[model samples]
Target: MTAPRSAAPERSVVDRTLSILGAFDKDNRTLTLSDISRRSGLPVATVHRIVNKLHGWGALERCADGGYSIGLRLWETAVLAPRSSALAAAAQPHLVALHGQTSLATTLAIRDGGESICLSFVSNDADAVACYGGPGRRLPLHATAVGLVLLAHAGDLVQKEVCSGPLRPYTRHTITSGTLLKRCLAKVGREGHAVVHGALSEGRGGFAVPVRDGRGVVVAAVGVVGAVDVIRPARLAPQVRAVADAVSRCLRADRPRVAEVGA
Candidate 1:
């Protein structure tokens, strides 16, 4: 026909630049030029040019080992995102109070597509379930208490996508069955909070409650994590719910008002 329509059009400069940046993640923090090329599906020469420009602009940094990594400038820009920054600011004080009261790690997370991303984490024990409690960490939607609360409030599309199958099992207790996971979400909806025990990590547990926005839409989840024996859902659920409520109120007050039609 028309020369097979050239398969696909050439990627734009912006698309290439974004692909180069997207190649780096929590696991692949540093990569060589070839590594970027392979990960981004761009030619080595093209990657070299784009990487050089990003390095010059301080969006990428060169390691002593001659590898590339995301730069501090990107982080500086990322913190300005109102979604995470505003939520973190509103939840920090309450999270601190919760941590102080329970002597457990506290966290704030938001759902991004099918995963939960931790925005704020308050904990003295650096090694206590770092994967789940560390800020900027991504977790499965079916595993953690914070994740379950967010998933419970998430739209049906996300639910269907996650429950469609291939659920990863983190531990013996992780809910790998889509049927069981759906039931758990339904229970969380009725209870207004989630108490997960040994799901992500053995001997660890979590408690979470949903944070709603001004329009009463669930926007985030705040929670506490500790040893399974120490979680005590009966005692902690109310406290977690209280902090969530406080954050929701703050979000409602901070929302911009639309002026009256004729005012």
Candidate 2:
């Protein structure tokens, strides 16, 4: 009998390229060529060719220490993503106003799969800001106020998948049980907001309200993070809701014009 052929490569060029990009994260911001190869599970030679192309195209930057990091060009391209850009633009003024009013670290985030991706963050306290993470950072759906709000409003499949267990615990207070998470999400849905204390970080709390679109679909979340004592759910919930409502209105107003153009 003829020799059986080896299995074909499972990933396409696009998949490999995206994998290389995805290899960089908050903890692994800068990586050597070998590091990329290992993280992406591609051969060093393959990584070398793709990394060179990506570097030349400004998607990746070569460092002085012979490491690679995501380039500003990638950020420029990413910010232009319609959902994030439009949401940021409409919510920027409101985010600023909220920060000015409360002097707390505020954030806007949207759900991507089971995680929440921060679109905008405003704060003066570096430590406070770091607790919530900067823009583009992925946060757990069950561990953050904005994340809980988003998860509560997400589709049933998405909610079920996230609550299926293996939920990461950022702190002792972080909800890790599937049954408990479902209960929490149900409460968030009924309340229309989420207030989490020391869930993602000890000694800190988060408050978030859902942002709806024209059809009243929850599309995003906005919230603030501060010391546990400073985050009074009763006091901050209404303020956060007001900002969310304003952003929803702005999104609703813009959607009609886009529809007209598409029409």
Per-residue C-alpha lDDT of model 2 across residues 1-263, encoded as one tens digit per residue = 99987799578999999999989998899999999999999999999999999999999999999999999899999887777888989998999999999989999998888888898999999897666778888888899999999889888888898899699888899999999999999999898889999999999988999888887778889999989899998889778889999998999888832211101
TM for candidate 1 is 0.88
lDDT of each: 0.87, 0.88
Give residue 46's lDDT in candidate 2 (0 to 100): 90
Query: Over the full model, what C-alpha lDDT does candidate 2 score relative to the true structure?
Result: 0.88
> How much is the lDDT of residue 214 in candidate 1?
72
Q: What TM-score would every model get versus the actual structure?
A: 0.88, 0.92
The candidate that achieves the highest TM-score relative to the unseen native structure: 2
- Go through the candidates in order and give the C-alpha RMSD of each one to the true structure: 4.5, 3.4
Worst 10 residues of 1 by lDDT: 254-263
Off by over 4 Å in 2: 1-4, 7-10, 256-263
Clashing pairs in 2: none
